[model samples]
Target: MTEMEWEGEFDPMSDPEEQRHLLSVLDSFRSYRRLAHFNGTHVRRQAFYSLPQEHWTLLSKPPFSVLDSFSKLDDLIDCNAELAEAIFKAGFRAFLAPTLDSDWVASVVPKKYADDDFRTYSIIMDNMKVQTSQNDMEKARSCINQFYREWSAEGAVERSKCFEPVLVALQHEFDMRKEADPGLDRSAVHVLAPGAGLGRLVFDICRAGFSVEGNEISYHELMASSLILNHTENVGQFKIAPFALSCSNHLSRTDQFQEFQIPDVHPSSELADAIGSKVPAHERMSMATGDFCVLYSQHEHKHEFDAVATVFFIDTAPNVIRYIETVRNCLKPDGIWINLGPLLWHHISRKEDDEREDKSRGRRDVVDAGISDPGSVELTNNEVIALVEHLGFVIITQKFNAFESGYMSNPRSMLQSSYRPAFWIARRKPSSS
Candidate 1:
């Protein structure tokens, strides 16, 4: 065994290369941070399984186009080898941890570029996109920006991280929806991904035949996602719309999601351009943003959607109670709520325990934001379950053992990295009151 194994978890810290692998993953984010609106707030911490197996129904077919099928699926996928090859270039190897070993990585990756195994989409394509350092982020931004500039493209579609599990969850939801309502328009599904940094998760859903809209609060990040998604759907013969893009919680246009490489819509009149984008006449897509809590009811869109998903989202919102309430308001009583990712104590580290570690690293801004809300405060898994149950919904299924699911990538490449995702596929308890 690699020196990286531990008793309760997969341990990679013991290996000589452990530091290199972990450092590589950590460094990836810096690159994104420089060009992105992310404030070094949260790190992924652990790895999760993603792609074809977990969310098969989505990658099964294309979801979007500027208007129609101008690009053939065969054409875009033909470059799959090129895309896969680009991943291992230079420092990206850090994404693979020391514990992974040659055999595992080889299994997940195509044996040879021309190998028949490469003919299979799932065998070749894996969304292993993870965090890197600022310099890498800068390089990525520069390259992406240049790609857009040269191609006269608008944006690249960002797909959700940990793709396989997301797909699995999506497949389960799709089956349930069909069973629940036979006449339902399968395509009427519209997903709202808040804090859609780089549009990863949003695009994954979009690839599933659902209409998606990402509500981003950060400006540059929005620009990056918008640029990639917009341009990808435009120039590529395999053009596909990632999702409906927009930024809310933003009072000013400049302050919303905009990545470094992308240029303003009109450059001179950003606010006017945003207004124009919303005009319905000039827009290539649709979008809106508001507090998810009471947002549906406030907007009079109560019981509007068939499903409202939160992937690595609930952790960001400390108020699970209000968050669920808001999600409940939007979902039809019989609608499904597929909640994934950790209910992390992160997004808000405990401020009261200042004496436990460093006091200078105090988080006054977030604490003041809502650190006072008892329900919003971080709690244990048991606490999460009690709260969700009290909210009057039933937990359907959760796969906390994704690490054991046997994906080709060993999640614990760095330290004891592994993921535990929970789901509460619930229906609103019929109100007797």
Candidate 2:
């Protein structure tokens, strides 16, 4: 969310818990960059050396050119290193300096996190020696890959398949409302998008003449998205080799090292062009950084949104019933609720539950947020719809197997996975039954 207001001048470092969290996030980025170098050079070289000498000699010829492959891999590593550096710099800036300076920071960030003193604190964090786990490196790598999914030209096809339908449904809703009430203003339509990773769908909704707020809980995602949304000045301003670290499922070496320009379209410029001087783009778009249930379930948010649109988001909940209830609370009477996603429940697996527990262990904010449920209740697509219908929603339109889509997929990879997500538009009843 935009910077919140504080009752007094707050000091972020005063809170030991917040200080630790901030340092941990910064260290994760640093470790990610360091691991990229190790993986790109030392690990690959060791693997090359492990091969039989005779086979290496034979493969060193024109057909295989083992040495040449090493050189190419090195070059790819350099590209990835550059991308990692950019990610670190951007993430650091977003964490320390948000768009609007306020005494109170976003929920995930410490209060008064943007103070100039934090820059000095960042240096201390950089100098501190901390052990980085494999899991941290993997999470950092996934954050980089998300850039490819949300902001690159290559990701547009997937976005179109997944995001377009939601936009269309919203537009239809807006049109119907305007037709029924001739004096309705387009700018009055406010939409809440939960699990809004990188905010591509939120940006699309803003472009379609609606005020939209994107809610995200992951600091990794919020940091990266803030860079793209608020900091990016031009299209193709940044380039990243998202697939560089993946050594498997490659049809060709080129595919593994492919580079993609971020922000296929510059956010501000596109918004300005689509929405002229009548209303400023910044006022229409915002982000809320916290758990969706915690933030939206507050009484102030009740009946505050005209519509709630979810894209590949519902499955992340530990309890889908709470999600539905939160949605119901957020909407006005006869408000629209649009959902598109698969039934891949994020908390179903024991491994995922363990990860969640580990991440939430020492954080009081997380524990107090009421999200520490042990496991999720997995439901079939039809069962999910039945729950929605039973929870005081009238299905307006729904299509099962709406379309097949991919998430952060590499088009040139030898192996690709897809999901056949369900799509539905439902309206909240005047009151719960």
Candidate 3:
């Protein structure tokens, strides 16, 4: 185990290598701190379930308190080998098994790329350190801002089961509408996938025979997704090395280098062949980069889409009501909106009185003048659902589920993170005739 030490400050103008090292080291220390917090928080939550066959060997045959005979020389010098082994096995079962499970999710790096793995691993591993200094919030901000986009893109899954609800609901709606009017044009069905990262979901929707446009706000993701969608030949086969920590639950050591394939939109030729359509996938699909709330206000896009789909995106906005209103404007009457994501809001908040003042007067002025404002406070899931209904959206289908979802999550940690995602399908109410 690496000795715990204090974090040191670094010059902002340092070389890229040094800067990378500084950030990685600080992140390692942060991870250690987060793990410590997790342990402390979960100490009392015991799992009463039966252990699997592998862990059966760890239980003691009989229990006896060694401290009862502490005065005896043998008792003081005794080595309880079985107890030590049991503890080690339990730690391994929780923290180490997940890394192996990760390998099953995606292919591992080949032997030829072993050098590449070690090269990347060395860079991250060499910087691990015990942080003893006072917390630095600015450093945390810098690290997250620099790497979060890349991490998100690399972690996208090939076919996320989380998307099943949206797909199934959409297909049912499409079939129902078609049956009602047999002459309806299938090719004219359009979908708007906002906050789409790397265009995987959009691509899949297009494959299902809908004209899809993906909208993203982050330039980092836009650039990376574009590279995968338009430029790469075998786009879905793209891969990257993500983690650098070793399997021993120690930041000081390095895990064996492994690469995982990142999910991307299918190549244009393949999609065209599968869809049997004259329009290619590139033509059937497009990406627009901008704040989604303002995207349609300038273009001839109002009430244009047949449906809107958002996965892991509604929570990105500070005020989700704005998103709901935007969806109302972007969809035709009775147009569907399918959303799947946790309601955990990511934006920071301000005093309610100040928010009202800005809304009553200066908010529009600030936006028109391109002056940025602090994001709106997050709303609970129930609040957002009620807001959608108040905005004239009739809820069609609503389902709730809890599961783990994310890219590049550390496989060594058994602290598998999960969220309660709300799968909602709603439609815009037609105007009163």
Question: Which candidate gets the maximum lDDT versus the true structure?
Answer: 2
- Candidate 2 ranges with C-alpha deviation above 4 Å: 1-19, 94-123, 128-131, 350-368
The C-alpha RMSD of each candidate to the native structure, in angstroms, is: 21.6, 5.7, 15.8
lDDT string, candidate 2, 144-213, tens digits: 7787888888888898898888888877877899898977766778899998777788888888878888
Q: Number of clashes in every candidate structure?
A: 50, 3, 1
Residue-level lDDT tens digits of model 3 in 1-433: 1111111122212344323333333333334324322332222122211445334333312242212212121221111111112222222222223333444322443445455533223232333332322232222222222222232343433135566667787788778888988866545678999887656677667777767888864333443455445444554343333332222342321232234443333456546565534455555676675567766443467888999999888887766767887888889899999988887665444345324423332224225311023456668778888999999899988877645565335544444455667888888999711
> Looking at candidate 3, what is the lDDT of residue 117?
33
* Residue-level lDDT tens digits of model 1 in 1-433: 0111001111234443333333433333223322232221111111111334545444334452211221221222223213222322222222234434556557666556435432322232243343343443433444333333222233221122344555566667766777988765435665556556545455445545555555543223433444444433222422211110122243332222222222313221322233312222112223343234423434476766766667667776656666766666666665666766665655366444322212222223334222133444677667876776687666666555443221111122222233556645565665500
For all predicted structures, in order, the TM-scores are 0.45, 0.86, 0.57
lDDT of 1: 0.41
Let me know the TM-score candidate 2 reaches against the reference structure: 0.86
Question: What C-alpha root-mean-square deviation, in Å, does candidate 2 show against the real structure?
Answer: 5.7
Lowest-lDDT window of 10 residues in candidate 3? Answer: 1-10
